[model samples]
Target chain A: MKFHWFHLMSYPDLPDDFREKNRSVWVDVDPNLYDPEVGHHAYNEYLDELEYAGQMGFDGICVNEHHQNAYGLMPSPNLMAATLARRTTEPKIVVMGNSVALYNPPTRIAEEFAMLDCLSGGRLVAGFPVGTPMDTIFSYGEPPATLREKYREGVELILRAWQEPEPFAFNGKYTQLRYVNPWPRPLQKPHPPVWIPGGGASVETWRWCGEHNFLYAYLSYFGYEAAVKSMDAYWETMAEMNIDQNPYRAGFLQFVGVADTDAEAEKLYAEPALYFYNRCLHWYPGFTSAAGYMSVESMRKGIKSQVAQAGSALSSIGQVTSTETSWKEIVDKSYVICGSPDTVVERLEDLATRLNVGHLMLLLQFGNMGKELTMQNTHRFATEVMPKLRDKFGDHVDHWWPSSGLANEKTAQPAPINSELGGNSQPTPD
Target chain B: MEELNLPSGRSAKVFTFGDNTAVGDNIKGDNARQDNDNYNDSDNCNDNNLPLVFFHSAGGVDENDPFLNQLAASFKIYAPVAPGFSDLEELDDLVSVSDVALHYDDILEALNIAEFHLAGHSFGGMFAAEYAAHYPKKVKTLSLIAPVGLWNDDYPVLDIFATPPLELGQYLFGDPDSELAQAFSSLASDISGNEEEIVESIIQTVQGLVTAGKYMMPIPDRGLNRRLYRVIAPTLLIWGERDQIVSANYAKDFAKLLRDSKELIVKGGGHMITLEFTDKLVEAITKHAK
Candidate 1:
C-alpha cells in the first residue's frame, strides 16, 4: 500500500478555556488569538515536518485547504505544496487541493497546480474538493443551492484549461473566460491524478468519484472502526455500479502516533489528541451544513451525519461536534491509533483488509502536537510501522498516482540500528 | 386554489379567494392563459375593490394564512407560493432578487392579471419591492412588512438560520410565550402524535429557512437598494415595534427610497405581524390598498 504523510498544522497554544468560552474554532474564531509570531514559526516547522517525512521515504506528503480556521493553517495549500516541491524531491507533492467554487476564475488553480507539477517534475496528485460549508457557503459566500453546480463547472473549466490543446473560449454559468489558456502547463501527461478527499456523506460525491475514475479519499477524525460500514457501503456502491473493486480506487486518512510501548505512546499522544478532538474540531452546529448544500436526493439518502444508520448511534460515530469529549472516550471510540508499532500495524492492517482501500493517507501530525513529539512519532512510525504495511496491497497498480517521477525509488527504509545495539537509546521520561 | 403551469417547467401553486375575481374574471387553474388574448381594463375595478396580489411570507405559501383570510372579506386575494420554498430545484433558475422579480411577473401574467395592489411580509416583502421596481406601473400600491434587503451597521441583521429551532420564537415574536407563538414553537411536537405529519412539519419549517436563505444569507442586499428609485407606486413600509429580526427603524431605510411612502410601527408586534397581530395588519392593508 502507498502511504502519504499528512499534517493538519492545527494552531498550537489555544487557551485551555477556548472551548468552554467559544461557540466555534472556525469561521468566526477569534483572530486576536492567532499570533503572527507563532504562525511564522508554525509555517517553517510544519514545512519541516513534510520535508522530514519525504527524507524518511514515505511515498507522498499532503496539504489541504481550509479558510479562517485555527485547525488548518493552510488557506492556500498550493503555497505549502510549492515550498515542499522546492525542498523535497522523492515524495509526491499532494495538494488535496483548493476549493474550486471559492475561486472566481478557478483557472488560477490550474496555473498554480501546473507550476507545482512542473517544479516537482510531474510529481503532483491534484485534488478537487467541493469544500466544507464553512469554507464555501459561509466563508466564501457562495449560495448553497448553486455550490455543487458551480464546483462542477469550475472543475470542467480547470481540466479543460490544463488539457485542451489550444486556447478555447469557455462560457460557464458561474465562470466565463473568453480565452482559456494557461502557461507553464503541468509536466504530467493530460494532467495530474485527481483525488477527492471528502467528509463521506454526500452520495453524489461518491458517485462522481466512481464514475470519473478518480480516487475518493474518505477523511474523518473518527477512525477506521467508525468507518467500517461507510467504506463497506462505498465498495457496495462500486459493486452496484459495475465498477472494479481495485482497492487503489479509494483512500482513507487515519491519525497515528507511535512509541516503544503502547502505554508510553498513549501518554505521549494524549494531550494533542484531546486538544484535536476538543479544540481543533470544535465547530458551531449552525455552520455544519448550509441550506441546499445537500440535494434533496442526498437528503433522502440521509445526508452527511444521517447516512450512518448505525441504529440510534451507540457510539460517537457521527456526533463528533459535541464538545468536552475526553481523550479516553476518543480512544475508546477508535478515533486515533496511538499505541506501539505492533498495535498500530495490527489495527491498520485490519482496517485496510476490512475497508479494502489501498491508498493510506497517514496523518502523522494533528492538533497542537509540538515539533519534538511530532518528529518522535514520525521517526518511530517510519522506522518501525510502515515497513510491515508497505506491501499489503503492493501488487496492485495505483492508476490514480502520477506516474512520471515515481520509479526506481525504494519507499521502505528499515532502521539501521542493529538488534543487539540497544537501538540508539534516547533518555526516557521517567 | 389550484396549480398554475408556467414557462420553464414551473408549476406555481396559487390560492385565489373572494367572489370578486378581478383578473381572468373568476377563471381558475389550467384554463388560465398568459397570452393576454381576453384582456380588459375592467378586471382592475371589480365592485370598486382593486385586485390584491398578496405575496406570502418566507414561511412559504399558506392558503389558510390568518391575515389573508381576513383581507379576503373585502378584496380578492391572489396568493402565489414563491419558487424554491416548494421545490428547491427552482432555486437553480434564480441567482438574484432580479431573477425572482421576473419569475413573479410570469406568475401574475399566467394568472392573466394586469394591475393590482401588492403586499409582502418578511422575505416576500423583499421580493414585492423588487417586483414593483421592475414593473412599476402595474402595481397600484405597495406594502412591505419587515422586509430584509438593507444592512444597518448599528442594528445589524441576525443570522436567522443559525438560531436554534426551539429558541426561534425569541427572534420572531414580540411575545414569544403567547398562544400563537407557542403553536408555532410546538409545531413539530403537536399533540396529534402523528409521526409522519410531525416530521413533515419540521421539514417544512427547515425548508422555509433554507429557501429564504438563498437570497437573504450573508446580507440580503441583492442590489434592491440601487433599484428602489425605479418603483413609482404609493408604498407603505410596515414593521412591528418589537420586531427582533429586522427592527422597526429599518422602515426608514425603505421609506426614504420609495417615491411616495408612509411608515407604520404596530404596537407590541414582532416580525410575523400577520400571525401575531392579524387584525392590525388586515386593517392597515385594507385602508392602504384602496
Candidate 2:
C-alpha cells in the first residue's frame, strides 16, 4: 500500500472560548483572529514538515484547498504545490486540488497544473474536487443548482486544454473561450492522473469516477467504520459499470498518530485530536448543504436512507454544530487512530483489509500539534508502520501513482532538528 | 381543475369555474350586481367576470387551496403549477425569473385569454409582480399578498431556505399553534417511519425550495424595484401584520412603487396570509379585482 502524508495546516492558536463564543470557524470566520505573524511561522514549519515527510520515504505528499477557514490555512493549494516543486524532490506532489468551478476561465487551472507538472518533472496527481458547500456555494457564491454542471464543464475544458494538441475554439455553457489553448503542455502525456476527492454522498460523483477510470478518494472526517457504507456504495457502482475491482482505484484519508508505546502515543496525541474534531470542525449546520447543491435524484436517494435521516435530524436540531465530541469519544469512533507503532499498524491494516483501499492518505499534522510532536509522529509511522503494510497490496498495479520515473528513487533520510525554534523542540505535554 | 400541456415541454394545472355559455348575453346584467353576494355563484350568475389567474406560493402549487376555491366561486380561476415546483425535469429549461414570467405569458396565450386579474401569494406574488411589470397591458388588475420581490436592508426577509422544519412555522404564521399553521408546518414534518413516505415528503419540500431558489436564493431581490414602476395596472398590496418572513413594513414600499396601488394589513395574519385569513384575502381580492 502507498502512503501519502497529508496536512490540513489548521490555525493552532484558537482561543479557549472559540467553541462557545464563535459562530463558526469557516466562511465568516473573524479575520481579526488570524495572525499573519503566526501564519508566517506556521507556513514555514508546515512546509518543512512536508519536505521532511518526502525525505522520510513517504510515497506522496498532499495539500488541499479551503477558503476563508481557519481549519485549513491553504486557500491556494497550487501556490503550495509550486513552492513544493522547487523546495522538495517529493515524487508525487498532489494538490487535491483547485476548485475548478471557482475559476472564470478554467483553462487557467490547466495552465498552472501543466506548469507545476513541468516544474516537478512530470510528478503530479491532479485532483478535481467538487468542493464543499462552504467553499463553492457559500464563499464563492456559485448557484447551487448549476454548481455540478459548471464543475463538469470546467473539468472538460481543463482536460481538453491539456491534451487537444492544437489550439481550438471552445464554447461551454459556463465558460467560453475564443482560443482554447494552454502553453507548455503537461510533462506527462495526456496530462497527469486525475483523482476526485469527495464526501461520497452524491451517487453521480461515484458513477462519474467509475466511468472515467479515475481514482475516487473518499475524503471523510468520519472514520473507516462510518465510511463503510459509502465505500461499499462506490464499489457497487463500479461493479455495475463493469470497472475492474483494482483496489488502487480507491483512496481513503484517516487521521493517525504513533509513538514507541500505546500509553505514550495517547498522551502525545489526545489534545491535538480533540482540538481537531471539536474546535476546528465547529461549522454551522445551515452551511452544510446549500439549497439545490445536491441533485433532486441524489437528494431523494439520500433522504430515504436511515443514515441521512439521522444526519438530517442532527443538523436540524443544531446537534452537529454545537456538540463537541470528547477525546475519548473521538477515539472510540476511530476518528483518529493513535497508539504504538504495532497497535497503529494493527488498526490500519484492519481498516485497509476491510475497506480494500490501496492508497492510504494519513493526516499526521492536525490542530495545534507542535512541530516536535508532528515530526515524531511522522518519523515513527514512516519508519515502523509503513514498512509493515508496504507489501500488502504489492501485486496490484498502482495506475493512480505518479508515472514520473523519480517515484521509485530512495530518499529516506532523517529530517534535521531545529533546536533554535523553541516550539519545534517542546516535548508533548502529558 | 384541468391539465394543459404547454410549449417548451412545460405543463400547468389550472382550475376553471365560471360559465362561458352566457358570456355576451348577460354582460351588463353581471356588471350591475358586482357587489351582491349572489354574484359569487357563477353557475347561476349573469356576470362576465374576467378569468382570474392565481399563482401558488413558493411552497408549491395547490389548486385546491381554500382561498383559491373561494375566489373560484366568483370567477373562472386558473392556478398554473410553476416549473421546478413539480417533480418535472423540465425545470432545467427555466434559466431565470424572466423565463418563468414569459412562460406564464405563453400559458395565457395557450389558454386563449388576452387579459385577466392576476393574484399571487408570497413567492408567487414575486412572480406575479414580475409578470405584470413585463406585460403590463395583459394584467388588468393585480393583487399581491406578502410578496418577496422588494428587499430592504433594514428589514431583510428571513432565509426560509435555511430554517429548520420545526422552526419554519414561527416565520410563516402569527400563531404557529393555530390549526392552519399546524397544517402548513405538517407538510415539513417527517411523521412516517416508512422510508418511501419520508423520501417523498423530503423530495416534495426540496423541489419546492429548489424552484424558489431559482429566483430568490442567495438574495431575494431580482431587480423588481426597477420594474415595479412599469406596471400600469391598478394594484393591491396585502400584508400579514405579524409576518416574520418578509416584514409587513415592505407593504409601504410596494404601494409607493406601483402606479395606482392601495395597501391593506390584516391584523392577525402572517406570511401565509391566504392560508390564515382566507376570508379577508378573498374579500380584499374580490374588491380590488373588480
Candidate 3:
C-alpha cells in the first residue's frame, strides 16, 4: 500500500498571554500564531518533513492552502509545491489546491498550476475544492450562496484554459474573457489528474467525481470511525453512478503520531490531538454556516442521516458535547493512531481492512506541534511503520512513478465487490 | 496634431508632441448617439517605425483629451477604432472577453507592429493589463490610468465632480447611459458654445461604449499577484493621485510585486486624470521609455 503523509505545517506560536488564559484557539485558533520570522522557519522545516516523507518511501506528499487563519499557514500551497519541485525528486506533489470560487479569473489558477506541473516534470495532482463558507465569504468576499455556482464556473473556465489546445473565449455570469489561453502547459498529457477533496456525503459531488473519473478524498478530521462512514458513503455513491468501485481510487486522511513504543507515542500525541480537536475545530466555526450552498437534500438532513446529499453544508456543532477529549477515549475509539511501529501498523491495517481504503493520508504536522516532534514522528514512521505496512500489503502496484521497485502482489487485499464473502450480497454492502 | 477626413471613407486624427503618438476618428459620426444598434468593430495600425501603441480615453475624440494626446506624442500610439466608437463595421456577435482578445490580436498584426509598448487610461487601462498578460511577448511596456481592475475590500472610492457628479460617475463607471454623459461631459469641458452641436457629438460617440466596454475583463482572484511573474516585459504602472476609483496603494503594491516595473502617480487628477494631467503623464511615459 502506498502511504501519503500530509503535514498541515501549522505555525504554533500563540501569544504567551492567550495560551496562559487557556483560551480556545481550537476551531478558530489565534491568527497571530503565524509570525513571519517564525512562520518562515516553520514553513521551511515543514518542507523538510514533506521531503523527508518522500525520501522515506511515501508515495506522495500533500500540501494545502488556507487564508487569514492560524490553524494552517499555507495561503498558497503551490508556493510550497514549487519549493518541493526543486527540493526533492519523485513523489507526486499534490496541491489540494486553490478554492475555485475564491479565484477571480480562474485562468490564473490554470496558468500557475500549469507552470508548477511543467516545472515538476509532470508529478502534479491538481485538487479543486468548492471551498468552505469562511474562505469563500470572509476571505474572498464572495457571496456565500453563490460559492458553489461560482466554483462550478471557475472550474469550467480553468479546465478549458488547460485542456483546449487552441485559443478560446470564455464568458460566464461572473467572469468574462476574450481569450482563454495559458502558457507553460503542464507536462502531463491533457493536464494532470483532478481530485476533489471535500467532507461528508456530498453525494452529488461523489457521483460527479465518479462520473468524471476523478479521485474523491473525504477530509476526515473527525477520525477513523467517522472516516469509515464517509468512505462508505463515497463508495455507495460511486456504485450508484455506475462507476467502478476501485479501492485504490478511494483515500482517507488521519492524524498520526508514532514513536518507539505505543505508550511513548500516545503520551506525546495527547496534547497535539486535544489541541487539534479543541482549538482548530472550535476556532473555525465559520466552516459550518447557513450559506445557501447546501443543496435541498442537505438542508433537511441531520448529521449521520442516511439521506445522501451533496457536500455537507452545516456542521452538527452541538452533537459532540464537552470541550475536551481524553487520550483514553481517542485510543478506545481508534480515532487516531499513536503507538510504536507495531502498534501504528496494527491500527492502520485495521482501518485499511475495515474501509478497504487504497490510499492513506497521514497528517503528522498539526495543532501547535513543533518542528522537532514532527521530524521525530516522520523518522520513526519512515523507519518502522512504512516497512511493516509494505511487508503486509506487498507493494506491487502497476504504476509507481516516483519511487523504485515493485510491491509484492501477495499482500494485496481482496476487491470489495468480490465473491469472497458471498456471491448474493448487496453490491455495496457496508 | 492633425485631423483629416480620408478619401477612403475613413477619418484620421493624429496626435504627436510629448509622450503620445496616435491616429483615430469616430465612425458613426454625430448621428448614432444613444443608438442601441450594435455595430461591427475593427481596427488597423501599421506603425512599422513606432515602438508603442496607446489607446485614448472614453470619447474617442483623441485631439481634445490633452493628457492622453500628450502621452501619445511622447510614444508611438495607435488609438485605433474601438469598434462602434470609430467608423469601423460593428458586430453584435461578441460574447466573451477572450473573444475580444482574439480580435485585438488581429488588430495588432494588422498594425504591422509585431511587438510594441502598450498603455490605456481609465476603462482602457483595464484592457491593457489583461492584454499584456495574455500576449506578454507582443507587449514591451504597459501603462494604465486610474485602472479599475483591483477592487479589494479596502479599495479607494472615487468622488464624482459633475453638477450631478455621483450620477455621472456611476454612468461613466458602468451605467449604459455612461456614453451619453461621457460625450456631453468631454465636449462641454473643451468648449462652451453651441450646446446643440456638442450634444450631437456626445450621441455619436456615446454608443462606442458597447464595444469599448467589451475590452474590460473581470479581474481574476488574486490573479494580478500570481500572473506578475508570467509577464516578462518591463512594466510601467500609473495611477492619478486624485483618482478615487482605485487607490494609490494598489498601484504601490502592484509596482512592488511587478518585477522590473515602476509606478507613476499623477497629482491633481481623479479617475479621469487621463484627461486632467495629460502633460505630466506624457512626460512620465517618455522618461520610462528612455
Candidate 4:
C-alpha cells in the first residue's frame, strides 16, 4: 500500500467559549480569532512537518484547498505544492487539489498544474475535486445548481488544454475561449495522473469517476466502518462499468496517531483528537449541506441512506456531527486510530484489507497538535508501522502512481484538431 | 382548484374561479378534471371581476391557507403552484425566473385571460414583479409581499436555506408562541410513523428552495431594479413590520422604483406576513385588487 502524509493546517487557537460563542468554524467563522502571528509560525511549522514526512520516506505529500475556513488554512494548495516542490525531494507532490469550478477561465488551472509538474519534475498527481459546499457554494458563491456542470466543463477544458497541440478556438456553455494555448506543457506525457476527491454524497460522481477511469478518493472525517457502504458502492459501480478492481483506483483518508505504547498513544492523542473533532468540525449543518449542492436524484439517495443509517445499530456517522461525543467514543468509533506500532499496524491492516484501498492518506497533524508531537508521531509511524504494510499490495501494479523517474524524457506533441471545420481530424467512432 | 396538463409534460395546480370555462378536456392523465374545478357561483365571480392570480411564496401554495380562502370569496382567484415547488417532478424546461414568467404567460394564454391582477408573496413576489415587467399589458395590478428580487448589501436578506428547521419560526414569525408559529414548529417535529410524510414534506420544501436558488441563491438580485420601471401596472408592496428576513426598509426602495406603487406595513408580523397577519394581508390585497 502507498502511504501519504496529509495535513489540514487547522488554526488551533480557538477561544475557550468557541463552541458556545461562535456559530461555525467555517464560511463565516470570526476573522478576529485568527492571529497572523500564529499564522506565520503555523505555516512554516506545517511545511516543516510535510518535509519531515518526505525525509522519513513516505510515498507522497498531499495538500488540499479550502476557503474562508478556520479548519484549513490552505486556500491555495498550488502555492503549498510549489513550496513543497522546491523544498523537498518527495517522490510525489500530490495536490489533491484546486477547486476547478471556481476559476473563471479554468485554463489558469491548466497552466498552474503544468507549472507544478514541470517544477516538480513530473512527480505531481493532479487532483480535481468538486469541493465541499462550504468551499464552492458558500465561500466562492458558485450557484450549487450549476456547480457540477461547471466543474465537469472546467475539467474537460483543462484536459483538452493540456493535450491539444495547436492553439484552438473553443466555446463552451460556461466558458468562451478564442485561443486556447497554454505555455509550458507538463513534463509528464499525456499529462499527470488525475484523481478526483469526493465526500461520497453523489452517486453521479462515483459513476463519472468509474467511467473516466479516474481514482475516486473518498475523503471523509467518518472512519472506515462508517465509510464501508460508500466504498462498496464505488467498487460496485466500477464492476458495473467493467473497470478493473485495481486497488490504486481508490484512496481513503484516516486520522492516525502513533506512540511508544497503546496507553501512551491514547493519553498523548486524546486532547488534540477531541479538540479536532469538537472545535475544528463545529460547522453549522445548514451551511454544510446547502440547497441544490447535490442533485435531486442524489438528494433522494441521500435521504434513503440516511434513513437506513438511522435504523442501523452502527450509526456512528450521525455522531460525527454532534458536539457531545467524548474522546473515548471518538476513539472507540475509530474516527482516530491512536495506539502503539503493533496495535496501529493490526487495525490499519484490517481496515486496508476490508476497504481494499491502495492510497492511504494519513492526517498526522490535527487540531492543536504542535510541530514537536506531530513530527514524533510521523517518525514513529514511518519507522515502525509503514514497513509492515508496504508489501501487502505488492502483487498489483499501481497504474495511478506518477511516472516520476521518467520526467526527463521528451514528450510527443498532440495531433492537431482542424479548428475551421469544427471537428476532430481523427476518424469518428461508429 | 384545477390541474392544467401542459404539453411540456409538466402539470400545474391552479385554483381558479369564473364561468364554467373548461378549455382543455382532451388532456389525459390528470387528477383534477374540468368537473373537479372548485368554482363557487358567488356574486363577485364574473369576468368583470378581472381574475386575480396569486403566486405562492417559496414555502409553496398552501391551498387550505385561510388568507387565500378569504381572498377567493371576493375575487376570481387563480393561484398556480410554481413548478418544482411540490412533490411533482420539476419542469426541466423552467430553469430561470424568466422561464417561469413565460410559463405563467403560457398558462394565461391557455386560460384565454387577456388581462388580470397578479399578486405574489416572498419569492413569488419577485416572480410577480418579473412577470409584470416582462408583459406589462397582461397585468392591471401587481401586489408583492416581502418580495426578494432586489438586494442591498447594507441590509441583506436572511438565508432561509441555512437556518435550522426548528429555528425557522424565529425568522418567520414576530411572536414565536403565536398559533401560526406553533403550527410551523409542530410540522418541523419528527414524529414516528409520520417519517414518510415528514420526509416528503422536507423534500418538497427543499425542492422549492432549490428552485428559488436558481434565481435567489448567492444573492436574489436579477436586475429587477433596472426592469421595475417597465412594469406599468399599479403596484402595491406589503411588508411585515418586524421582518427579520428582508428588512422592512426595502419597502420604500420598492416604492421608489415602481412607477405607480404604495406600501403597507403589517404591524406585529415577521417575514411570513401572509400567514401571521392574514386579515391585514387580505385587507391590503383586497384594497389594491379593487
Candidate 5:
C-alpha cells in the first residue's frame, strides 16, 4: 500500500463549547476566534511536519483546499503544494486538491497543477474534488442546484487545457473560452495522475470515476466499518461497469494516531481526537445535506444523503454527529485508529484488504494537535506502521500513480531518510 | 390527473377542477374517446367555463385545497404541479424563472387553454407573475399572493429551506396556534402510526423545497424587476401585513412595475394569507378578476 501523510491543519483554538455555542466551523463561522499570531506559529510548524514526513519516506505528502472554515486553514492548497515542492523531495506533492468548480475560468487549475508538476520534477498527483457545500454553496455562493454541472464543466475544461496540444476555442453552458492555451506544459507526459477524491455516495460520481479510470478516493470521517457501505458501493459500481477489481483504482483517507502502546496511544491522542471530532466537524445542521446537493439519480437509488458524507459527514449508521461522540466511541468505531504499531497494522491490513484500498491517505495532523505530537505521530507511523502494509497491495499495479520516477534514472530509487531533509530533529516522544 | 403531452416532448400531470372535466381522468390516453373533456369537477364549478390557471407555492398544491375549492366555484381551476415539486423530475429544466415561465406556457398550450385568468401564491405567486410577464396578452387577469420575484436588501426574502422545519410555521402563518395552522401542523400526526408513510411525507416535503430552491434559494429575485413592465394584464398583489417570508413592503415593488395593478394587505396575516384568510382572499380574487 502507498502511504500519503495528510494534514487537515484544523485551527487549534475553538472553545470547548464551540459545537453548542457556535453556528458552525465552516461557512459563517465566527472569524474573531482565529488568531493570526497562533496561525503564523501553526502554519510553519505544520509545513515542517509535512517536510519531516517527506524525509521519513512517505510515498506522498498531501494538502487540500477549504474556504472560510476553521476546520481547515488552507483556502488555497496549491500555495501549500508549491512550498512543499521547494522545501521537500522524494514524496509526491499530492494536493487532494483544488475545488475545481469555484474558479471562474478553471484554466487557473490547469496552469497551477502544471506548474507544480514541473517544479516538483513530475512528482505531483492532481486531485479534482467538488468541494463541500460549506465551501462551494455557502462560502463561494455557487447555486446548489447547478454546482455539480459547474464542477463537471470545470474538470472537463481543465483536462482539455492540459491534454489538447493546440490552443482550442471552447464554449460551454457555464464557461466559454476563446483560447484555451496554458503555457509551460507539465513535466509528466499526458499530465500528472488524476485522482478524484469523492464521498462515493453519488452514483454519478461513481460512474464518472469508473468510466474515466480515475481513482475514486473515499474520504470518510467515520472509519472503515462505517465506510463498508460507501466503499462497497464503489466496488459494486465497478462490478456493474465490468471493470477490474484493481485496488489501485481507489484511495481511502482515515485519521490515524500512533504510539508505543495501545493504552499510551489512546491517552496521548484523546484530547486532540476529542477536539477534532467535536470542533472541526461541527457543521450547522441544515447545511450538512443542503437542498438539491445530491443528484436525482443518486436519490433514486435511495441514497438518502449527499456524496457519502465527505462534505456532509453526518453519521448515518451512528446517527450521532461527531461532536457528541466520546473518545471511546471514536476509537471503538475506528474513527481514529489509536493504538500501538501492532494494533494499527492489524486493523489497517484488515480494512485495506476488505475495502481493496491500495492508496492510503493517513491524516496524521488533526485538530488542536500540537506540532510536537503530530511530528511524533508521523514519525511512528512512517517507521513502524507503513512498512508492515507496504507489500500487501504489491500484486496490483497502481496505474493512477504519477509517472515521475519511471523516466528519470536518478529519481528511480528514492534515498533513505536523512537529517539533511529535516528528519530526526525531534527526539522521539516515546 | 390531466396528463398533458407538452410540445417540448415532456409529459406532465395537471389537476383540473371545473364545470366540464372529471377529477383525475386520463385526458389524452385511450379513454379520450370515452370522455371528450376530463378536467376535475370537484367543486361542481358554475358553468361559466372561465378558466383560472391556479399556480401554487413552494408549499405545494392539492386538488382539495380549500382556497382552490372556493375559486373553482367561480372558474375552472387548472392546478399543475411544478415540474420537480413532488415528482422530483425535470428539475434541471426549471432552473430559472424564465425556464419555468416557458414550461408553464407549454403546459397550458398542451391542455388547449387560452386567454385564462392566471393566479398564484408565494413561490407560485412568483411563477404566475413570470408567466404573465412572458405572455401578457394571454392572461385576462392575474392575482399574486405573497409573490417573491422582487428582493430588497432591507426586507429580504426569508429562506424557508434554511429555517428548521419545526420553526417554519411562525414565518408562514399569522398565528401559529390558530385552528387552521394547528390542523396543518397535526397533518403530520394523522400518519404518525405508519413510519413508512411519515418517511415518504418527509421526503416529498423536502423534495418540494429542493425543487422550489432552484428559483428561490440564496435570493428569490430572477430579473423580474427589469421585466415586470411587460405584464399588461390587470393584476392584484396580496400580502399578509405581518408576513415574515416576503414582507408586505414587496407589494409596493410589484405595484410600481405593473401598470395596471393594485395591492391588498390583510390584517394580522403572515405568508400563508391564502390559507389564513381564505374567505377574504377568494372574495378579493373574484372581485378583481371580474
Candidate 6:
C-alpha cells in the first residue's frame, strides 16, 4: 500500500539566469541565454520539489539517470539522489537509477550508490536498466548486442560489492574487477532492496525479478492500458514460474494527474506529456538499426508496436517522430490516468485489484510540465487517493514498504507534511 | 536489468538462439539466407569475397535469385531477413522508415561485417537509400531496384483490377489457372518459377504475412527530401521500364539526386526484373560491382 512518487522534473522555461549553454558537451542545447548558473538554480528548485513531495506523505521519492537530453536534466541521478539523501530523512530514496551498461566501469554506480546510502542513513532502492539503444549506443558507445551482457555483469559486480564480506577477484567478458571491495556498506544489511525498471515486458527481467523476489516496476511512457497489458504479460510469466502473486513484488508506473474536475486535469496534463514524448525523445541517427532478422512474433507479441513489420524501415531516415497519440487515444488504450481525485482513485484501485499487484509507482513530473501544476496534482492525490488506499489494505501484505525485514531495509515513513489546513503545506528540505 | 525466470522458479537470464535452424528455411520458407548465400562463384576466387547484402522490398521476398546470384558468383552476398519477417527475435519498438534505417545500423554493427555492398528492392530500396544517406562510408556501392522513395507526381495510377489473382496470373505466366503463376504473381515476377517451388514458397510466406498481420501496416508519408539529397555513395539505379508501384519516371529523378551513381533500365521487364530476367540483371550488377 506504500506509494512512491517518481519525478523527472522536465522544465520548459528554466530561470533565464540559471541556464547553462555548455553544461553538457554531448547534447545540444539552446545556445542563447543557456547559463550554467541557471542550470544549478533549476536543479535546486527541482530537488526542493521532490523533497516537498517526500514531506507531503509520499513513502518514497524517485529520480532517474539520462544523458544529453532535456527530457530530463539528470544525466547523473546519483548526484541528485546524494543531495536528497543528505537533505531528507525517513522516506526511502530510490534512484530509479543508473543505466548500468552505459558506464565503462560500472563500479562507478556501486560507489555513488553506496555514498548516497551512507549519506541518507541507508534508504536506497537500486534500479538497474539496459539503457535505450539511443542512450547506450549513440551517447555511451556501448554496442546493442553486448548491452544485455554488460548489464548482467554490472549487476553481479555491484551486488557482490555490497554483500561479499571479504575482498574478491571478478572477471567477465566486458568488465573485470580485481579488488572487488566497496566501502560504506548500505544501511540495509546485505544491501538495499533491488528495483528493476523494465520499459516493457522484458521476459528475462520478469524471470529475474520473480526468481530473486525483487520488486519489478514496469516503467511505462505509453499509458495505463498498455501498462496493464504489459503487466499481465509479466504476470503470465510469473504464474508459469509459480512466483508469488504478492502485491509489493510487482509494480506498475503511470503519468498521473488529479484536479477538481476530470476535464481540467486532462487539459492541463495533455500538452506536457505530448511534448516530452514527441520532441524530447528524438535520437540522432544510427541508433536503432539491427543487422539480424528479429522474428515477427517478437515484434508484435513482445516488442509491442504496429511498426514492427516495416522491418528496419521504422528506424530509417526521413521518418519524423510520429505525433503523440491523443489523451483520448491513451485512455481508450489505458495509457494515462488524468481525472478528479475520485475518478483517479477508482481507476487506480481497479487497476491494482485487477492486476493483483502490490506496488504502484506514480510519475508526477512528465515532459516539460511546470512545477506549479505538478505540485497541484501531487498534493491533491496525496490528500485524497493515497489515504484511502493506505487504510483499505489489511495485514495480509505489509502495507509499509522498506520494512525492516526486507534485505534493503530503509525507513518506510515519508517526511512529515504541513498539517495546518491547506495553509503553507510545503515540505521542508532534508 | 531483470534476470530470466527458470522453469524451476529460480531466476536465470541466459537464453541463446544456439545455432537453431529456421523452420522455414525449407523450400516453402523462402530461405532468404540461402538466396544471399547462393552465389554463382564458379570462377577462381579467394576466401576474401565481397559481401552483397540484399534488402528485400515491401513484399519481403528475396530478389537476389538468378540475376543477383549470377553476379554474386563474383562476390560474397549476405541478404538479411526484413526485421520481424524472419526467424530472429522480433522488434516491437520500430515504426516509420527512419526507425528501420537506424536499426539497420545496429544489425550491421552486430554482425561485424563493417564494409559491404548494399542493394535493396522497392521499399527495401528506400531503406537502402536511407542507409546510404546515413552511413555512406559503410556502403561500397548501392543498387536500388525500382526504389520507391523518389516520387514522380506524373506516374501512372495503380489499377488494382488489372492484377487481381486471376488477371495477375495471366499477366505474368500466361495461365490464369496455374497455381505456379498465381504464386509467382502473388510474390514478385522473378520469384515465380517451377510450379512446385513457387507454390510452396508462396504458401509459407503468405502464412507468415497473415500471422504477422497485426504488426504490418502501410508506411506513412514521412519527410524524405531533407535526407535524399545527402547520399554520397556511388549508386546504381535499376528499375523496370514499366514499373507501376514507384513509377519508371522516378528513375531519372533518383539518378539526378544521387551525385555519384549510374542507372540501368530492364527493358520490358517489371519491378522484379532481378528474378525475371536474371542474365541481363546479372550483367548490370557485375558492371557496378567491378
Candidate 1 on B1-290: residue-level lDDT in tens?
87888886778888886765545645332222242443333454332455788877767767667788888886788988888777777777787788889989999988777778899988889889999999997887898989888888988877765554545666788888888788776652243444344434445555666678888877877888888999998898989999999989989988878789999899999898988888888888778875
Clashes of each: 0, 0, 52, 0, 3, 57
Task: List TM-score (chain A only) for every prediction.
Answer: 0.90, 0.92, 0.83, 0.91, 0.91, 0.82
Candidate 3 on A37-59: residue-level lDDT in tens?
A: 98778777788889988888787
Instruction: Pull out the clashing pairs in model 5.
Output: B1-B24, B16-B40, B21-B39
Angstrom error of the Cα, residue B18, model 1: value is 3.5
Worst 10 residues of 5 chain B by lDDT: B23-32
Q: Give model 6 RMSD, 1 decimal.
A: 14.4
Error of 5 at A369 (Å): 0.4
Every model's DockQ: 0.28, 0.30, 0.01, 0.34, 0.21, 0.03
Per-residue lDDT for B1-290 in model 5, tens only? 67777877667778877564432232222233233354334353222344788888877877788888887777668999888866656765565788888999999877766557899998899989999999887787899999998999989888665555545665678887888677765563243344455445555665777777778767788889998999999999889999988999999989999989998999999888888899999999988875
| Alpha-carbon shift of residue B109 in model 1 (angstroms) | 1.1
Q: Candidate 3 — what's its lDDT?
A: 0.61
- Residue-level lDDT tens digits of model 4 in A1-430: 9999998899978876788888789999999999999999999999999999999999999999999988999999999999888777655998999899999899999999999888887889999998988899888888776788889999999999999989998898789999999987887878888999998767899889887778888898868888888888888878898988888899999999898776787788988887888888998866776666777677666665564455421111121234645888778888888888898899899888877899999999999899999999999999999999999888998888888545345433323456655546676799
Q: Is candidate 3 or candidate 5 better by DockQ?
A: 5
Per-residue lDDT of candidate 1, residues A311-354 (tens digit): 22111112224567787876777788878889889989998999
Chain B TM-score (model 3 vs. true structure): 0.64
Candidate 5 runs further than 4 Å off: A303-323, A405-430, B20-49, B86-95, B179-203
- Name the lDDT value of residue B65 in candidate 4: 68
DockQ category of candidate 1: acceptable
A381, model 4: CA deviation in Å? 0.9
lDDT for each residue of candidate 2 in A262-311, tens digit (9 for 90 to 100): 67767888888888877899887666676677877666666555435564
Error (Å) of candidate 4 at residue A391 is 1.2
lDDT of 6 by residue, B110-136 (tens): 444566677887657777888888877
Candidate 4 residue-wise lDDT, B1-290, digit = tens? 77777766667778664432333332111212222442243443333356688888888876586778877766667888888776434545666778888888877766666667889989889999999999997787899999999988889998876665666777888777888888887666444455565456557777787777777878898889999999999899999889998998899989889999998888888988887888878877878876
After TM-score superposition, what is the CA distance of residue A195 in candidate 4 from its true location, in Å?
Answer: 1.3
Instruction: Write down the RMSD of all candidates, one decimal each.
Output: 7.3, 6.5, 18.9, 9.2, 7.3, 14.4
